[model samples]
Target: MMVKQYLNDLVSLFFPQTCAGCDVPLAYGEQLICTACWFHLPYTYAHLDSENASARQFWGRVKLEAAASYLYFKEASRVQQIIYHFKYKSRPELGLILGERYGELLKESPPFNRADVIVPVPLHPAKLRKRGYNQSALFAEGLCRAMQIPVAALCLARVKATRSQTQVNRYARHENMLEAFEIRDPEIIGGKHVLLADDVLTTGATIEACASVLLDAGAAKVSAVTIAKAL
Candidate 1:
């Protein structure tokens, strides 16, 4: 038994599993990120501040109960590295890990703790087919695990694959995505405080497009959450 333990320790030393954010060697209980990196993660905490930029984005476009993003994403930041791994490197588990951590922080905030159900922004069928998974849904699942909330997967639908909003102005994005989303089932969300989740928030165009549909379908109110907010 001692030999087995010794061998395990020797192998761990050679591999020296490290944190994604800080590259510190992880302890036995740690996963992708180490304790230092996890605790020192750069968080946005937008949910704690009602007038944050995240909520302000939907000022006249839609009524949001609250809005927040977990992290601030810059070009070469640690948050960006983690996001890149989760979104593009086939690491679905990373999405779940991030969601759980972020969700815990969100629960301490006012509006988030009262969410009726979580709904991830739906990806277009074509995109889902190509990616083989919805990254936002993975994040939502992680959130649900942390918050003990149910996820309403069918509450929103992506009706069209609109052009990328990155190259367009806010006005152009809204115009282009005007008819991009639809609500398939109003019964699930009627009079409910819905938490709309996504992997990232850039211009908030996609969230707005989907929120408009949910509101039209009788959602009492809509709030937004994302793993990161692109700055």
Candidate 2:
């Protein structure tokens, strides 16, 4: 064991791992993010209140039981950079790490703790193939690790490939997302309080569509969580 540790330390010295959030070289015992960047992250604390901005975004549009986001996303901010890397730069593990951290906090929150199963917003088949992974599913995987709850990735699926919601108005977003998702296996979600997770929350039309399908499939309740909120 000592020899193995010595070899690992020698390897790390030549190729030091860096923090995902800040690109700073990580010391021993540090994981994806360094201590300093983790401390400086703009945590939203939205789970503490059901009426927080994240939850309110779904009000009257979708009947969400609760909602929360782990961080606040700002243009050119570190959170944005982290998410960009997580989504487009092949750093899916960062999504998992963030999700696990968020899940640890959600475990203490009453509304989120009521979740029976976690579901990730699905990617269209073509997009999933191109990306090689679904970012939201990776995030949900981490949440499962921390929460000890099962993730039902096959329960919900995106049946249609819509244009990006970026630069779109609310009305356009709603139109583009209409009937975009479908319940692939209603049995898994039936009578369960489902926690639908995504990478971020903007106008929330995508989540609304996902929640509608889950509710129609007989899910007892649906709540949403995201890595960040772009407000």
Most accurate candidate by TM-score: 2
Worst 10 residues of 1 by lDDT: 16-25
Candidate 1, residues 1-231, lDDT tens digits: the string is: 999999988999898776676667889878987777667677877878999988887899878888888888888878887887777767788888988987888777778889899999988999888887889999999999999889988778888889877898878888788688888888999999899999988888888888888888899988999988889
Query: What lDDT would each prediction earn against the true structure?
Result: 0.85, 0.91
* lDDT, candidate 2, 1-231, per-residue tens: 999999999999999988877888998999878899999999999999878999988888989999999999999888988998888988888989999999999988978888999999999999999989999999999999998889999888898999878888877888778668888889999999999999999878889999988998999999999999996
RMSD of 2: 1.7
Candidate 1, TM-score vs. the true structure? Answer: 0.88
Please name the candidate that would achieve the greatest lDDT relative to the true structure. Answer: 2
- TM-scores, all models, native as reference: 0.88, 0.93
Q: Going through the candidates in order, what is the number of backbone clashes in each?
A: 0, 0
lDDT over C-alpha atoms for residue 109 of model 1: 74
